[model samples]
Target: MGWKAAEKLIRHWKVLRGDNVKKHIKQGPGHEGGIFTVEAPFHASNFQVLDPVTGKPCKIGVKYLEDGTKVRVSRGIGASGSIIPRPEILKMRTTPRPTVAGPKDTPMNLVLEKTYEPKSGKGMPELINILNDVANGLGSSTNL
Candidate 1:
């Protein structure tokens, strides 16, 4: 997808990760960050969650930076029964040896079959016209 498309998707999802550093500073003690930040602490490599069925602790996944550096996040239970943690520290684990590709020997044409409809025609035309103008401008400039 293009930049505009990706931006639209982000706007559509409206998933707020957490507050900015400034918000954290201004909010002071009682206000905990968003759900994602609260869940981060439980994501530490050493952190473990008890499995109700087995009554055993299961290790959580720890995410690393692109350079393979371990990310350190702060996680703590606050006075108001809130959990706080660094974004990097929280991670979720996936099943081991998950399927890389779909069923083997499947035809290539059937790879992607998902489609999404526009929410409304309100902003669609404007966005499309803007992009069309930009493309036309680029094409004309190249020929000049």
Candidate 2:
């Protein structure tokens, strides 16, 4: 086999070995700033999430229990809807988190309407525009 293939094989083997040993991974300060702990090889095969009704692969959604504890539920539609029982197979699974987006979708030009500008001025229009841009968060000092 090529050297690259051999190296890839070695990396895969190491992950498997670590998972086999149940290396603990905790939070705080790694390259990702997570805690230092034992590493475990995680592969989908080891902890499968399947739709109960169709026996097909599915995504899990999280909902809180009546007692306020969190649990995973099947996101599958129709009659396939069901709560996922704690997997008797895998010992651990990370909780799913919602992703968030910022102000990137907001249009900067819309922050100040043209009709609102000073009709005739030497520097008044320019000065007020900059102040309005900063106040409305449409622009910043760094852009200057």
What does the lDDT come to for candidate 2? 0.62
Kindly report the root-mean-square deviation of model 1 from the true structure over all alpha carbons.
19.3
Candidate 2 wrong stretches, greater than 4 Å: 1-48, 76-79, 89-144
Candidate 1 local lDDT, 58-80, one digit each (tens): 44334566888664332233122
Every model's TM-score: 0.17, 0.28
lDDT of each: 0.45, 0.62
Q: What is the RMSD, in Å, between candidate 2 and the native fold over all Cα?
A: 17.4
Which candidate number has the best lDDT?
Answer: 2
The per-prediction CA RMSD against the true structure, in angstroms, equals 19.3, 17.4
**Backbone clash tally (model 2):** 6
Candidate 1 stretches greater than 4 Å from native:
1-66, 75-94, 97-99, 103-130, 133-144
TM-score of 2: 0.28
Q: lDDT of model 2 at residue 108?
A: 52
